[model samples]
Target: MSKEEQAMKGLWDMFKKRMWLDSFRMKESLMAYNPSEIHCIAYIGEDMDSNVTKLAESFDMTRGAISKLTKKLINKGLIESYQRADNKKEVYFKLTSQGKKIYNIHEDIHREFKDRDQPFFNQVTEEQLDVILDFANKYNTHLDAEIMKLGIKMRSDNL
Candidate 1:
């Protein structure tokens, strides 16, 4: 309602829009795989302890959904499942050579993105960068708390 409130609201809206647009562009660039599948691949590539449960938890998705994605990735020859010698009942996923290629491409894209933004970042003062980082950290912490609250509410509702 006030000028300051309106300005802050506008800034937040624009920031959200920019992020959505950037995500859309990235999705378009990685047309071979959908965002979820690429994310799963990247996660498996990075974390040796990755499993369906871990992937689901990391992505805030259902195990069933992650299982379906893993199945699709397997069908595409991007990932393979193996059982740990210590735990025969549990299955884990690892990226195949093909999956590694996709992961590399994703990494390259991110690297290029950062490189492209480096000039602007280089111009930002340390104080300004710190302010941005602090804002981001606080915003993410708030979102995590909200997600936990929603999870509790959902579990209670299901009872």
Candidate 2:
């Protein structure tokens, strides 16, 4: 095979492995929340009292799916629902104490995964990190444009 092809294959393999490791970590540690749920919770934690529609757009999920999932989260006491202060008709979701607990667990799982995978980048230098970051941003931009063409949502910034 050509050197370029070999490099591409290696990158694909690394991405696949990363995804698999993340799935495994979620499965092993997150007893109550699925990956999607945990992702939603994390987003809410990041942007407190965000409306369901915004959350749906951010995650590339349907509004109905976001609503159903948020309802389940509310029932589990992991999130609380409230009316938006600026717009009374718009309902927002926020993480409760129980939600914070689950978020902390998710953080721990992420940390453990990072620690275990440290060897993969143990020798990477700042210059290499910059190159990787630039590549990632460009790739994400291309992907975002393609997704937008398909009528999917697009972020304000590509990366």
Candidate 3:
């Protein structure tokens, strides 16, 4: 393979490894809650209109999956569901007192993580940061397109 291909392969491998390690570390930090649950709590805490449909769209998951997660959260006493006065049929989720505690913990962990990286970010020039941001966005967009194509291919093959 060309040097460019070798470099890209190395970067991809390291990126995957880093992501796996990060998930493991986060799992440890989250203790009782899984990453998805933590994410759901955070999202519910941040969004006023958090519902099964919104969660499903935000997380790119099925409504059934979000419902299951919501049920689990409700059982854990981390979240509660209520309907607005104007919409009896429409249910929305909000973090309970316990859920707020977990959300605050998650936020603190994230804030500390960012603070730990502050020195590195401080060292980077604006131009360098812009280039990095641009590259990251392009790479993410490409991956999203590729993932959609792969999903379509898989569905077609199954059919």
lDDT tens string, model 1, 117-150? 7898899999998997897798879867987888
Please give, for residues 1-159, the per-residue lDDT of candidate 2 as tens digits: 999799779999999998897888788878667877899899998896588888988887778889998999999899999886678898988899989988888888889888987897898899999998998899889877888888955543332
What's each prediction's TM-score? 0.79, 0.80, 0.82
**Ranking of candidates on TM-score, top first:** 3, 2, 1
CA deviation > 4 Å runs, candidate 3: 1-3, 6-10, 13-25, 147-159
Candidate 1, run of 10 with poorest lDDT: 150-159
Give the best candidate by lDDT.
3
In model 2, the Cα lDDT at residue 137 comes to 94
Clashing pairs in 2: none
- Please tell me which predicted candidate would have the highest TM-score against the true structure: 3
Candidate 2's TM-score: 0.80
TM-score, predicted candidate 3 vs. hidden true structure: 0.82
